[model samples]
Target: MAGNKQIIIAIDKDGYVKAEVSGVPGPDCKKYLSLIEEIVNGKATDETLTAEYYQQSTSSQNDQTSLNQQNG
Candidate 1:
């Protein structure tokens, strides 16, 4: 798969937890992050978007285009 994804989780000495998602494209990455949030039982206080976060896969783009054409 072109968009092979991973989530990295870490905990500090004070017990603060952090998670980072990589290799996922577009808004779909949030689903993985949300799963991490549930495991940590906390809301995100900050976020950093990577290049992949802003990149949409060709399949997703085509799906969106098809929907727009159908609705329009």
Candidate 2:
């Protein structure tokens, strides 16, 4: 149904399984991604996000440099 929150799981012929959940939007999507990885398979072991992958707007990006300086 259109009103239902759907979690669609798919498996390929090669035995690779993946899942996708609909209706969870924004930052919550990342939580769904983790759950999908944990449930479908362990294919998400090595994951990284690129600068372009960060779709949210923040006040500043310069703070990362400051954090690195503190660590050093």
Candidate 3:
């Protein structure tokens, strides 16, 4: 019973499909979007970052950078 991820897809009369991924954060969403594009054999011509995308904390990013530097 996991409710963490959801992908909602819609198709128009012209056979255009739009997919939206919910419950996933910013950087991670890019991977899913790319996969969708590949599966659909289409290119994403435009994109807008939602507010949730910019809500990531600086401390988390800094921690990852610190870890990478230490391991590199």
- Candidate 2 lDDT over 1-72, as tens digits, reads 322445566566665554544443334445655556556544443333334234443211111100001111
Give candidate 2 regions above 4 Å deviation: 1-3, 45-72
* Candidate 3: clashing residue pairs, number: 0
Best candidate, TM-score: 1
In lDDT terms, which candidate is top?
1
Clashing residue pairs, backbone N/CA/C < 3 A, model 2: none
* Candidate 3 C-alpha lDDT tens digits along 1-72: 223666555556565666666556556666676666655566565555556656653211100100001111
Give the C-alpha lDDT of model 3: 0.49
Write down the TM-score of every candidate.
Answer: 0.64, 0.46, 0.60
CA RMSD, predictions in order? 13.3, 13.3, 13.1
lDDT of 1 by residue, 8-67 (tens): 777665657767766655676667755776666666766666554455554221101000
The collision pairs in model 1 are none
lDDT of 1 at 21: 66
Candidate 1 positional error at 25, Å: 1.0
Which ten-residue region of model 2 has the weakest summed lDDT? Answer: 61-70
